[model samples]
Target: MASSGFCSLGPTVTSLFSSHALARWRSSSISPPPLRISRALSAATTVPISSSFTWDDVIETGREEYTPHNSSDLTGFLEKVNRCNRASEKLAEFIPFVIEEQIVGYIHKGFTEYLREFHDIFTFSQNGSCPDRVDGFVTLNLMLEKPEDRTRAVADVIKILGDKGIIPGIRNELYPVKPSFNAPVFFSLERAAAPYFGIKGYGVHMNGYVERDGQKFLWIGKRSLSKSTYPGMLDHLVAGGLPHGISCGENLEKECEEEAGISKAIAYRAIAVGAVSYMDIDQYCFKRDVLFCYDLELPEDFVPKNQDGEVESFKLIPVAQVANVIRKTSFFKANCSLVIIDFLFRHGYLLISPTISLSKETSYLRLYIPDFNALTLKNLLVLDLVMMII
Candidate 1:
């Protein structure tokens, strides 16, 4: 939905990398040149260089045309799967519950069985349906008796699902159940069940990048092959879910320390950038998750040591090479690609051309920001421009 006006600026802006930086990047042999490099270096002579840059630069240097890469694969992965088939349509049978007219979570049609199985912890409409029929469509609701009882009820549900083998890879982690992102928590749910019930999940992703010899290098990790999800795939330096009762900052610091052995003081220096959201639906589950993104600049001498067994190894790769890996191979977790793309755009590595159609840009931006209902045409164009840059 990006505007044509903003999209037209693609060819006007100059290169984001200065001649000196480009020289170092090329010398490193991390990736091939994106465009034909002119021998002229006069344009870059007056540009100031600094390791400590601001987001204002991202906003300022927002015009350029970039050569395309294999980023289309990410677009295809995020396109909404057709649900017109009977099996997929069955997901519509569950109705979402609204509190203060905002969607909280869905109540499965079979929730009556749960009410009967755990009558002490659930309350259902006497008519077997909601009274209002619009705002109150859910047939069953969790009885919020006490703060402590909420965890107990979630435990019971986890036990029931475990016994039936309904949920996979239960991590024993707890996720808060709220009416909305800013709403008060009414109860808690097991991490695995959150997707099954279409609940919102939160997580954090920290990008560890460094400037060495005037070139940008990123620290990338390989997930352990034994991981239940995306095993052996590339991942950010430090990432983890926001568990129940923990703030985003706290969860990020914890993950930084645990996953990459970053000290608390160093981890606190990470800059909280923004968030990316997506809703993924498969045959048996639905996930509407959001990741809070952070960028941490590491010292040239710092070497990341994985304390958690989840990471197999770490590699220091140039930014362009990282972009190529994301574009050419399915080596990264699907969602991690979004985070990296965001970083690329924010840092001025990616730029979109005006020649590409709006539809193509829309498809690509959807991968990073799945829920684009509220995005304006200008915003969509900006994101599309960013993706096209990659």
Candidate 2:
């Protein structure tokens, strides 16, 4: 009886195995259906992807598709300023103010009342209802007899504005008064009103970077919450505006000490990479400024200590994360974004992809570097060399 039962079980097991094998063969013979291309993808093939980006993308217009709180504000401000400039017509209608042969500022016909009120401070070439624009400029003779006189004049202007409540208060910071971008300093002006007059300002920004385990990191500083402008905003490791009577190198060293507590020996190691320039205009002021950028590689053991109360804290962030912040957030000071973008380009982090347009790349390469015309041929050559080295 046992032998008969074993024989019956063997036949049942063999039948089940044959059915499973047949199912596996059928499954193996069937292939995955071809993937269907959607209409959207088919349309995408006709449009070429952009390979290049321009300075307008990141610097001028701010990044697209990620509108920060200030993006619209900046755009609106620029639009208003441009519209005001366009409404004014021929050169004769506008008052051209020259500094050492170049027209730096223009006073609109609307500001005639203010000009008349301050006529004592101005020396006109002719005396009449309307003075002829000399060489396309109605030069305002700021009868600055002495250096101290210029200071007093600037102070008096501030006082007049403050008395009328046009300006809230006077900031003690003094800015070098240049006729144009790189013209020699004619006098000093109050920092608060410098942009209001369309004066060109200079500043220095130091890029402090570290290498750890084959990755690059940047040393970023956060402005103190109590600071007046862009309070609590992110800043470069060391940055300061060029005050009157100080050279760029000297100002850089001083800022390194004051802002980051770096000794002169170490701070002087910073290499001048390049400069970034931009013109920002709003209802209140017009800012045409340039930042002299430097690259400094710090040792792994080195840490920054803020000597001035302006900085709240220091942080070491990876370069990738820093780029993300610039692209997605308005945490950084307006000009600081340009400096970081310059650093990324110099360090090869920002590259020209195959889809980027050649024209766009060329436009970015021609960054609005202020004072390029002011640079001597030799100096320009040297600058090109330094940029190549970067």
Candidate 3:
């Protein structure tokens, strides 16, 4: 659980006017963008957690567990519910709190079921306040799905959270399973960039947070990206995630070409790859096992033509213009809109900086590199320079 503060910093652009290169992104270009924004704001921090404990073990202690592809997992889950009520009965303190229990106790005193719940408590609780009262327990969404293969369920949860922010942005939600995974063995098979410690393989992605006329426009998607767990459905502005790694730099070029419809030149022109968020999509929250954010910017007129039907349409909405629309919009489908927005607002491109404009600024940065004037024969990271270490 973390704070909801959106920010980003990458190549900046000033002009919001149309560009010749961006002619194909209008409503008449192809089909309209069909994405919606997500409303959930609490950041879902996917820490590595394991819920390998079983019902038997939980009954002994106040803990629960779920094993992948196991029938007993369900029985154990139910037992947790029973235990919640038992906890209330056993303790005279903190009994029958929250709206649900209050109503339940009033309606039926001898309850047959337990409303067991789990939450990742934040320093400041869900309402953004450190609870002055220790007697009250927090309530969260039940979020249940019909029985399915463990892998399938995990994917569904990822889609659900990504598309609709089903998981609260900053709240502590229960981890039904432990978080763990082997980095795809295939990842280490790549050959290029291997000299740069652990660069056996690499992946690529882009984060497009745009602003127009002093108002930020979060491009959203209405359709679930194709080849995704939720196949052909509504989702976030940045729908793509965790692409397979190809050659060291080749993967980024391919992803931008395929997903964002940007030329390789433009992709190179606007690369801002960096580590942004901590995620455990595989076991903790669901979807691609892990992902890091990359930032990309272009002329305001740049419109993406999704080739694979992954993105149905795009909607450009005002930045501060979010509330019910986040939940209501289909484009901000990746439940991470708040996360994305927080990142953008905090570290997003500096369009109108202290003195410079975005394009001119980018031009300067592209041509300039850290000076080689430093007295260093051992500076190995200095690109394009062959220095002899004495």
Candidate 4:
């Protein structure tokens, strides 16, 4: 049994993105004045989060466990979901980024100023040129018709932005630009610039579990401190961004080999378990991400080794303890929490009562596990599960 009292949670979860901070984000509108006049282009300023908590605090919170409660008691999972889907009301600050009559993404109004310099490559259609076009939309120049041309032209612009430090942390990786997961690729963009363009980014996150004596345990990895994003945070056993020209299965297999030393044979047995999508708007960057989730039942004796320098360490923790870590602490990387919560829900580790209210803004997790007969299809959609957290 787990502890009934959530000692470590305190103000950490509520204060992560407090309402007061959100008010400031709302007030700091970077929408340029409605004049055709020109202003000097500069890098967009980042939104400041007013929180005193640090990553070390998050780590410390993960180490502690509450006592005297049922092992299946889960009240704090909703907080994890809230962390992933944030600043959605700030969506008004962005404008539709259309390409070939298709709305491919959204660019922040503040970031749009930077693109105004490259008139040949970017077209700002604010005059309602087409009937379907929204007011004040951005699109690529029609002259660069071919995907190759658009890619090269955008690459040149990204280079300039990278040099100016407007778009920092260039990973040198290419992410396919499209309206949806299955949509035709418009072109390839630098991975770092995806959020700035508000493109729908996709990634694969796999939960590798071991079934030992009818009990289940999960393989969790601590990200290396040297990582550019979410360093020193917990992560999925095998996870990677879906770069251009690679299938989700291929990317997951590659990540499994590189991150966890899993062979192709073992990786091949991993099942596609569905996906979770979240939309977050932060300052000049709007992140609309969809993560495809997978589950792999690993042999109990199969230990994971980090072939790449990305993961700091790996641990085989019981799934229930892992849930407590997520429910009580902000230790897991924001998106990873969603995948893990989905796993818990599907496995019957967390009981779902019908009294909870589902929020529209929450990231919707879709489960595709065929044999799991716990929740009905309609219930899965609503996710109206009760929370025992308070």
Candidate 1 segments exceeding 4 Å error: 1-93, 98-102, 107-136, 139-143, 353-390
Clashing pairs in 1: 1-377, 2-377, 2-381, 3-377, 351-389
lDDT of 4: 0.69
Q: Compared with the true structure, what per-residue lDDT tens digits does model 2 show for residues 1-390?
A: 001000100000111011233244334433322211100000001111121332233233332332222233222212222322221113233444444444455444444344456766654444333322433333444566565676677578667876776655468888876554445566677887775555667788889999999878899888887876767777899998888887667888899999998888888777665565544445445565766777788889889999989998888877766765565555667677667766765565543222221221111111322222333111321111011111
Q: Which model scores highest in TM-score?
A: 4
* Residue-by-residue lDDT tens digits, candidate 3, 208-302: 65766665555544453343333443334343332232232355566567655767776665333332221111211112112233455556987
lDDT of 4 by residue, 1-390 (tens): 111110111110111122344454334434322221111111112222222344455445555554324544443566666656666667667777888887778888899999999999999887876324345789999999998899999999999999999999999999998766566899999999999998888888999999988878899898888998888778899999989998777888899999999999888888765556666777898787877678899987999999999998888887877877777766788889878887876676564434434343323332322212322111112122333332
Off by over 4 Å in 3: 1-205, 224-228, 231-249, 277-289, 322-335, 347-390
Reference-based TM-score, model 1: 0.67
Ranking by lDDT: 4, 1, 2, 3
Alpha carbon deviation, residue 154, candidate 4 (Å) = 0.5
How many pairs collide in each candidate, listed in order?
5, 5, 53, 5
lDDT of each: 0.56, 0.54, 0.29, 0.69
Which model scores highest in lDDT? Answer: 4
Using TM-score as the measure, what is the rank order of every candidate, best first?
A: 4, 1, 2, 3
Q: Who is ahead in lDDT, 1 or 2?
A: 1
